[model samples]
Target: MVTLQLRQLTVPPGHRVILHNINWQEFEAILTELGDHRATRLAYSQGTLEMRMPLPKHEVAKVIIGDLVKILLEELEIDSESFGSTTFKREDMNFGVEPDDSFYIQNHAQMIGKERIDLKVDPPPDLVIEVDVTSKTQLDAYEALQVPELWRYEAGKLQINVFQDDKYVESDISPNFPNLPIIEAIPTFVEQSRTIGRSAALRAFRNWVRDTKNI
Candidate 1:
């Protein structure tokens, strides 16, 4: 019989290390041990686990994107709850993933005033934001968990993906915020934030959204 060993290695920041043949029990233990360490990201599917430490550039983009999402939600008067880097997992599906940022938009009511979220009973987040500066997204794990929406930012562009029939398909617009030009507008604002500073760029974005909505 071949038994897989739990191996550990040290890698540079933003590098991903794969742990092979790890079972659910061991994976849960590892997650518990890594608690509250916000810089690291973990993804697991079947028997494969991936761990990454995001670089500074990656984190900057992640924050800007998340901030923009919240700004849009607020300007639209849409209720939302942001969960930054929260680990979402499902035991029965043998999958687990942590998004750069996640939000409950349409499903915000269900999460109101709750201290802990259990996917087993509670509804999954309506939107998840992923910033892919170097690594590709682990879509298989998200698919297993049935997350409804995804926004992926890579190479200065944002792509919207909607989950349907157990798969994710690229979409030009978000179903929840259909009128907002999310794909085009977000990346543009991200660039503005980098050049003019986050606060100024955010104020401009809010003004733009208000004008656009009113027109």
Candidate 2:
């Protein structure tokens, strides 16, 4: 058997490693060992642990989508607390996931001034955004954690999944932004940010929202 520390293992971007038969104790220890400052993301469920590093393009999309989401909330005068990539885990459920971006909308009041989260006591984030989630394990982790709404950006398209009946059902429109055309605007602006510049795209998005609000 080979002995390696978490620090010794290197997971390249756009790739992941899966380990099975890991228990809850080991998962917590691994999280402690890995520490909070790192580029890797982890998803653990039912003794299976998967860790991966996100690519540059993946990061770009994450930031753009997250920014647009903030803009939407601001334009609509909705109060929200943004917890970017916070690690949410629970030993009881044996589920832990670190999303690219997380926001507290419906439950913003409870999360105010809370730097950390305890899923057993604290409510799961209202909206979570991730990039290129091709694995069922990640989705399973989110469902187990009982997050109300999840946003996934992949292949230049946005997928909104709502939790119901203990499962995730894909929906065309986000429950958080029901009246707005977020399904189209989110992706359009994210892509626009890359070409026209992030600042320009953001301004355009804000203007679009204000225009829509008046109509």
Candidate 3:
């Protein structure tokens, strides 16, 4: 027989505690316990446990938004780091959730550590991307982290939300990259990706840029 020990995690107000210190067997057991609940999902770290609930479908629009951001990053001259399906944890609530894609700009992008990020002090990603495939759990995760900027992509459109004045507000432009034409370029990228290979897409983008510049 295998046994698992549970430890309470101290989190700040408005955050929930995550249980820590369990083996794989224990982790599986917990999920089994919560089977078919549809209200919560459990995430396990090396020695930690994080519990989160589902969010509404509209809340996961960041996935498509992230794909758009990645393509833009490759085209622009800026130095940045982008991640797909990466996990971030907030110490205040012991909450751990994975973003569809997350990014950091310029020097801030280099600050990421090699192993695990210590979310207690490190600033959250400049942007969080989520795709509403099925559940609302993504929204619950973001709310717990109190991250600043989140872009959700759903129903074939993108919505940009920024955390300002202690709340989230929709914006016409992204706070992270004000120069990029997000709305104008996103749909084009999405449409192109569906019909052509990646190299072809790049060539088309180059042509579009040259034509727009009258070069």
Candidate 4:
């Protein structure tokens, strides 16, 4: 039987606590005990574990970015399978992580109608969104998982990370949105949501997409 004799540290919103020397069994047990409740996110890499609870700002960024991505996919007629904060893990690599939001685009057809995702069997998500409100995302963990693309939002700015040469390098454009300027477009619309309203902002965004893409 696996026993998790780990210390429980309660961190304030937007903050995280990291514990060292955690084994895979203990990490699995912790995840099982936590279950599907999403108030907190857990990440494990090698022998380290991190727990984070999203703040209101963090939540806002997540929703805005996720919604914009969905809009882009819809207008472009791109099929996607979203797994929001679903834990992606591989025991062999000793890595496990849950992005704020994740999606399967190029490989969406491969995961159709599936309830569970096994990283060992299925391809990793094509795009992962990270809202870095207080703590930095664990890039090493995602590297171990070999995620193709990552969008990290911090301080009202978006940074695109593309996997290349065994590392994630910051890029100005996304492979999925080669023509769209996502870095600038997303933040502008997200700010509009704050000034006008979500519905109004979304309406404007849709209009822009339709006019720009002739959709």
lDDT of each: 0.87, 0.89, 0.58, 0.89
Model 1 residue 138 lDDT?
A: 90
How good is model 4 by TM-score? Answer: 0.94
Note each model's CA RMSD in angstroms: 2.4, 1.4, 9.1, 2.5
Q: Identify the candidate with maximal TM-score.
A: 2
The regions of model 2 sitting more than 4 angstroms off are 133-137
Model 1: lDDT of residue 125: 89
Q: 1-215 in candidate 3: lDDT tens per residue?
A: 75443323333322344666656566556555655333444455555666654344323234434545665665555567665555676544645666667776643655655444667766667777765444333454565666777877665666788877666778888776576656566657655755785456656765554454342
lDDT string, candidate 1, 75-171, tens digits = 9999988777778888888998999999998889888887777899988889998999768899887888888999999999998999998899999
Candidate 4 lDDT, 64-175, residue by residue in tens: 8898899999998999999888999999999999999999999999988988989999999999999998889999999999999999998878999999988999999989
Evaluate residue 60 in candidate 1 and report its C-alpha lDDT on the 0 to 100 scale. 90
By TM-score, how accurate is candidate 2? 0.96
Structural RMSD, model 1: 2.4
